[model samples]
Target: MTKVTDVVLNLIKIKGQKKEEAANTNERPPAKKQSPGELRLHKDIAELNLPKNTKVTFPNGKDDLMNIEVTLRPDEGYYVGGIFVFSFHVPHAYPHEPSKVRFITHPNIDLEGNVCLNILREDWKPVLNINTIIYGLNLLFIQPNHEDPLNHDAAVVLRDDPQKFQRDVQAAMLGGYVGQVYFPRCK
Candidate 1:
């Protein structure tokens, strides 16, 4: 009985010593598991083939993939020659939830950069990806939708006088004042 007790005590001491050695080692803790959203986002980004005159960038560097910046320079349309920059924040629940997009002020976008795109709102689905959103944003510049707008005043002008809307867009792009609002030059 005494020999058996000594053997049990020695085994316990060995187990404790192993645990202490493991804790003292410089080995890093296990890497954090990537969420479903992150995995999907990574896949989408890897497969991106951006549209003409459009480019996607990572303002926070490649390490931070959640935050993205897209630059669009339309080759034709009322927004032609104008440089528009949009910031996109992909949620951890991305694809399940649309990425939050903020863009420069436009007829389809508010002064505070709130975009009015259906896919980014009610029409979003898990099947949609970053490429789709970029394409949609590019389309907005090609055809500024006055029917569904976040900037109502701009929309009204676009709906009522297409020519004046064009002029106003040009003026706004040149850092001129459009009514009471002043837009910085982006051309």
Candidate 2:
């Protein structure tokens, strides 16, 4: 049973020798090892097999895969015919941790980019995959769960008056005024 101190000292010695070797060779150190988060992202991207309407893009270009943008174009629902974009940021823990997701363009999204979804919050589990999350996000546009909502006003309207809520969603998606708020045309 090696003591913690002994293990740390051994690691330091190895790192020091590696640094010296790199210095002598006039070579850069290897890229920082990918964290669990990065490894999961690589796997998610490869296995995505996204729907035709959905596209994933690395905004920082190919090398920076930790951050990505997912575009969703739902075929049906209040958001139908409109394009929605969501940004995903994978933390160092990756599959061990849920990816942070924000809506870039959605009628219901607040200015702060807070997204309302069960899987991204209380329902998250290691067994749930990217496909599940993406589908849940699309459901947000289609269903817009007004019961558990980050936007209280939207939820209130949705609960109190279903027709008006649908109208408001349509107006917002069409780049019209649902009141003082002006939503850009997403179609």
Candidate 3:
């Protein structure tokens, strides 16, 4: 009876070991988890319907969805034929928090790339998506808001003298010096 019990126990152990090995061989490595913000951004980007003059690109490739670059080429505005690129860094608290946008060649944008768009700052809401921000940026080129500006001097000029403002914008777009700052040719 002792010999028979020992044989049965050894059989059980061998079966268990075989099952464990099979399970290990069939299992795959765990997939990396995506944060809620990444999930939301993925949805937003997948559903993007960009405007005719606006295009969005990922400098870090599609694998990294947090950083984005938006290029605008307005066809009928002060910035017509000019190319402007804005970088957007979406935070982990996106939607709840606004994206950080940086672009350096507009009346409402400073030389240091500080933007003064209402939706980007005080008026931002969770309901707004990337498309909303793109439209807002496009509108800025179409109709620059001198009332709220990051470049006060440019705003003042736009407000006080429309023609001079247009000339200055043209000059800047053509890679000329505006005041002490030189602008690169974006056209």
Give lDDT tens digits, candidate 3, residues 1-187.
9999999999999999998888789896545798888888999999898999999999999888899999999988788999999999998888888899999978899989988889999899988988899999999999999998999999999999999999999999999898889999998
Candidate 1, residues 1-187, lDDT tens digits: the string is 9999999999999999998788679577756788898899999999999987998999999978999999999999899999999999999998899999997668889989999999999999999999999999989998999999999999999999999999998999999799989899999
Q: Give the TM-score of candidate 3.
A: 0.85
Higher lDDT: candidate 1 or 2? Answer: 1
The parts of candidate 3 lying over 4 Å away from their true place are 1-29
Model 1 poorest 10 in a row by lDDT: 23-32
Error of 3 at 79 (Å): 0.6
Candidate that would win on lDDT:
1
> How far does residue 129 in candidate 2 sit from its true spot (Å)?
2.7
Off by over 4 Å in 2: 1-29, 104-108
Clashes of each: 0, 1, 0
- Backbone clash pairs in model 3 (N, Cα, C under 3 Å; residues 3+ apart or in different chains), count: 0
Residue 182 error, candidate 3, Å: 0.7
**Of candidates 3 and 2, the better by TM-score:** 3
- lDDT assessment of candidate 2: 0.77
> Which pairs of residues have clashing backbones in candidate 1?
none
